[model samples]
Target chain A: MDSMMMGAMSKDMMSMPGMEMMDMSIMQACMDACSACEQACTVCSTQMMSCAPACMNCADMCNTMMRAMMRMQGMTPAAMMAMLDACIAMCQVAMDECMEHADHSEVCKMCAQACQACMDACMSMKNTMMSMS
Target chain B: MDSMMMGAMSKDMMSMPGMEMMDMSIMQACMDACSACEQACTVCSTQMMSCAPACMNCADMCNTMMRAMMRMQGMTPAAMMAMLDACIAMCQVAMDECMEHADHSEVCKMCAQACQACMDACMSMKNTMMSMS
Candidate 1:
């Protein structure tokens, strides 16, 4: 998301209890990571490898996690934490599955990297939430 | 998804410990509904209504829920149930929010209907899962 969208999200998030501490910089990085991960996973899924199912699952979770950040008004902190955990778990699974064939396929290698980035971003979000709370 | 893709998903799902009872027809309908809902919500979000955030959230959840069904190998029944519940909740929130301005906007009206349809499809999936379990 761009700065303008983040600005809008900031306003929306301010209304939610305990969401005031949400750092837009961290969220921006997280959203960007999620978006990139989703794209990589989407492309990797089309390859029809054994890891395709995991890639597809990770793509969807990353997209959902990104949008959830954009729509903070619709989420409770508990729900947000649950979703971040889900995203992190999905990214991990996708990364592991993708890494199995990474040496044979450059796309799988790129996907694994993207999944790692997303997992790291999500964990950052989780840590931020915990520290803020 | 095409029948071939569904067939592949069906085969993958059969390998899951307790997913043998999953019905392809219901899953197909639910995936269609999720896709439609995502499209409608994407359009609705651009309108910048107070409900835009909810619409975006619903769209993401629907997409995630759809892909989750396609990737049953990546999920436990418990995770699937949690995602379904989350999708249903997001859809309800979006539908309720969109209905408030439905009379003023045709897109919102259509989005609301799509959300309702997606919610119903998800519920049908839930019912099937419960019965099979």
Candidate 2:
């Protein structure tokens, strides 16, 4: 996310209970990772491999996760945790599937990496929230 | 999305284990509902209410669910079931949140209705798959 958007979001988030204390930098990293994973998965899905469905699923989950962070007004910590868990699970599945073809398909290799990064980012966000509570 | 795309997907799905036996019309309805729900949720998110985050999350999940159905090559009945459950859960959350303001906010009312329709369509698709299995 851009600094301007982050500034806007930060202002809007002031009304949410715990959100005002959130580290925008960490949230921004998570969103960036989600966006990257979504793009990578979208490309990988077009490969027509057995992993395609999983990639597509991961892409959707990542996009949702990113958007949820952007719209903090609608989030409860519980719901946010659940969503992060789901995103991480989906990313793991996609990464596992993509890894099988990583040797031959560059797209799969990149996608697997993206999934790994996204999973890590989501976990980081989860940990941050856990500590906050 | 379109007849041409559906035709292409139908042809590509022929090799998937159980998908060949699936009903395209029901799948189409589910996809359409997801697409509509995603759009409605996206618009609703801009309202900046407490429901905005839920709406954003629902939009992403619905889009993901729709794409998963499209990429049958990547889905096992198990994964599909799990995804449907997640999407349904997210939609329910979004709907419940939106319903709180339905009396005054037309956008929330419409988003809630879209979430309900999407949930129904997804359930129908699940039932159809279960019967086939």
Candidate 3:
């Protein structure tokens, strides 16, 4: 997200219930990770491996997770938590699937790394929310 | 999806554990709905209303739901069910938000309609899964 949009989004989040303690830096990192993971997975999904489906699924999940963070005004805390969990689960599944082909495909390796990063970011967001609450 | 890609995806879905009973026509309609909903929401989000956030969130969810259907091989029945439920919830929220200003904005009216159509399609998919199972 651009600085101006992020500023606007941050302003919006302040009025949402249970989002007062959100760290913009943490959310920014997570959104960046999600964007990268989505890009990598979209590329990997064209590889025609059995992992392609998992890659496609993860790309969608990461995009959704990222957008949800940007649109916090539409979500409650519980809804955000559920979305983060779903994104984490998707990243885990995609990473495991991509790793199976990492030895043969460089794209798979990169995709797996992206998924791992996204998973970590989502976990951080979840933990941050828990601590703040 | 183009017919060529759809044909290939259909072939793949046949091998997934619980997707054999899927009706491709229903899947295609749902995909079309999702695609339309996503596009409409994307446009509607730029209107700077309180509904913008919900529209953004719905756009992401619809895109994810569409991709998940195209990549059924990545999903277990339980996971697919959960995703369908999430998509439905997102659509409901978005449609309600959009409808709030439907009388004033033509874009909101179209967006709400798209959301409603997407919800109906997703519900049909869920019902199909239940009946087949």
Which one is best on DockQ? 3
TM-score of chain A of 1: 0.94
Considering DockQ, where higher is better, how would the candidates rank from best to worst? 3, 2, 1
Q: Indicate the docking level reached by candidate 3.
A: acceptable
Worst 10 residues of 1 chain A by lDDT: A73-82
lDDT (10s digit) by residue, model 3, range B3-96: 8888888888877777788888888889999999999999999999879988999888888888888777776565566677777788888888
TM-scores of all predicted structures: 0.72, 0.75, 0.80
Q: Candidate 3, which segments miss by more than 4 Å at Cα?
A: A1-12, A127-133, B1-12, B130-133
Predictions' DockQ, in order:
0.32, 0.37, 0.40
Query: How does the DockQ of candidate 2 come out?
Result: 0.37
RMSD of 2: 3.8
Off by over 4 Å in 1: A1-18, A46-48, A71-82, A102-110, A130-133, B1-17, B71-79, B102-110, B130-133
Position A17, candidate 3: lDDT: 76
Docking class of 1: acceptable
* Native contact fraction (fnat) of model 3: 0.39
Model 1 interface DockQ = 0.32
Clash pairs for candidate 3: none
- Chain A TM-score per candidate? 0.94, 0.97, 0.95
Q: Which pairs of residues clash in candidate 2, taking residues 3 or more apart in a chain or in different chains?
A: A53-B74
